[model samples]
Target: MRSEFCNALVGRSGNENVLFMTGDLGYMALEPLQEALGERFINAGVAEQNMISVAAALSRQGFEVWAYSIAPFCYARPFEQIRNDIAFNDLPVKLVGNGGGYAYGVMGPSHHAIEDYGVLLTLPNMRVYAPVFNEDISAVVNCLSSELRPSYLRLGRGEAPDGYVIPQYAAWRQLTYGDGIVIIAVGPLASTYIGAFEKLPKTQRPNLWAVAQMPISANPLPSELLSQISSAPALCVAEEHVKRGGFASELALYLAEGGKMPKQFRHHYALAHTYGTYGSQQFLRSLSALDEGTLLSTIAEFAPTSV
Candidate 1:
């Protein structure tokens, strides 16, 4: 997905007003963009706050600016600048964060962005985008390009099942429709569910959906998704991010407010912080029970009938 984002940025480099600025990161993955963007590409050293401020300034001058860095650096490190200079002013500055969730596994919590979008979403004018598949990058880039507000693009791992046609990108789009449990996956974690779901028989498989955008109020949840939630016998929401301010939390609020809770509801997400351990993303996900095996088990448990 990082490579896809670089390619998308390079593809958009023809626009002189569009610029990409990184915080001395993106060593190999960003060569294409650097070459295509030329002087328009600025490596702002390791100063994330300054990078965001510069991007905001460029945006104020009518340029479409993107501040690039790893997920934590992009949002957590320069949060003050992001909130004041970009989001508060409603500048059209795009914050491109790579390695969302624990994608930078083994690098430890410093690189993890489990709380990134949740924190950014607090800004009233900020829009958060979490593309569920690599193929969604171009559409997401184009969508951000069309908007003139602060936005965050969280790049993570995702891919569609072979030969499966993903519908046009939307805030909420159904991947597979079935009875019983309605499974909702947020961001790149959608891939985890996509692969694990094949284990279940078609009769017991749940309806699958992915959420690509945030601040759900902006785009509004599709009526189809709402109807699925209402009718399904069980509901499960999974995400790499923590529960608070994430899809599950927001959706729960929506359901509770509307008095439409399902019979059985479960949320699989990054659990309590790992204070003394470090490993690969999959390793940590297993600890949180967010891995494929756990997902399959959960689905079987949630399914109306045995597989």
Candidate 2:
């Protein structure tokens, strides 16, 4: 996802008003951007808060500013500056957060960003984007480039299955259709669901969808998603982040408000128990029941009973 995002940044090299600033990170990965962008690329040392303040000021001065860092450093570290300087003023500052969720596994809770989107969304005029596949990065970058509000792009590794052609990126994408259950995977966790889908037989698969944008907007909800949820016997939301104020909570609230709640809704997310433990991302996901194996077992429960 980092490489894809850098490529996207390089693609925007012609835009003189655009700037990419990082907090002393991106050692090897950002050289292309630095070379392409020339003086427009900035390394703000280890000062995440100061980097954000400067970026916000640059945006206020009509520059398209994108501040980059690890997930926690990008948003959590300098949250007040983001809220007051960017969101309060409604500045068009793009924040690129690499290693979202537990991607920086074994680094402990301080590095994990399970609540990044939830916190950022609470601010005024802030948009959260978590692209589900590598192919979605370019489209997401394009969206952020033109977005008028302070926005955060949570980066995670995602790849589509071989021979499966992903459609052009959108806020909501129906990856597959089935009758028994509606499976909604947010961000790179969609890859886990996709792996589970491939392992299951056609009769056991669920209606699968991937969501990229956050702060659920149900104003004329996507008819396809609405129909899938309206008819499926069960609905499940899979995300790497915590349940509260994340994708699952927002989706549930919006569905209930619209009177389109499913009969059985389950949320699989990063559990608090794992906050005290450290391991690889896959290991952490297994503990949180967000891995492919756990999903396969969970989906089986929602399968149609034999006649």
Candidate 3:
């Protein structure tokens, strides 16, 4: 996603109105953007709140300002600042949260950002984006660039499977066709099942899809997307965030309010507790309920032996 962001900045080289700020967290991913955008790229130095405040001020002066940092600090440190300076004032400052979910494994719970989507989505007029496929990064960045609104971009480290790819940035991507049960995976978790799910026979497979863009912005899952797999016996959601206010919760409200609730519903997410242990992302996921094994096992309980 940072690669796409850098490319987009370079794509607008002469646009002096564009400005980038960081809270001392953009290591190698943002250096290219920094070099390409010289004075326009400023390091605010370990101050996420001040960084957001300054970006809000800059945007008020007709500059397109973007503040970038780790997911936890970007939101946690500057919660009030963002709510007031940016979203409250209706500024166009774009806040990008890198290393979303457990991306900063070994950095401990303080670094892992498991609650970003829920918090940001609840903010009035704050647009939240989570891109499942690396290829969709540029599209999300460019889409926000054209609009003048408060936006939060949640990004992963871009780890995808070897071959399967997607083009075009739809709010969601359908991964399979099934009539029994539908499994909805959010963020990078979509890639986890892409490999293992293929190993299942044609008849055993369930309809799989990736929902990245926040429903607050996308409004609702596309009518066609819902029509496709929603008829399944049950609707299961797998997310890297907590189960309460995250994607699954919002989806349930959407379904209930819209009278589109599926036959049955189930959700799996990160545990609602601090992840004390630090290790590889895979190891961390295992500790949480979002591990591939746990996710599949959870779904298996509701499906037949074919799954």
- Candidate No. with top TM-score: 2
Q: Write the per-residue lDDT of candidate 1 for residues 141-239, one digit (tens) a residue.
A: 999998878999999988777767778877788877566588888887876666557656776777888888988778677788778878877789888
Q: Report how far off residue 202 is in candidate 1 (Å).
A: 2.5
Write candidate 3's Cα lDDT for 19-67 as tens digits: 9888997787777788878999899998888898999999999898888
Measured against the true structure, the TM-scores of the candidates, in listed sequence, are: 0.95, 0.96, 0.93
Winner on lDDT (1 vs 3): 1
**How would you order the candidates by lDDT, starting with the best?**
2, 1, 3
Using TM-score, rank the candidates from best to worst. Answer: 2, 1, 3
Off by over 4 Å in 1: 305-307
TM-score of 2: 0.96
lDDT computed for candidate 2? 0.87
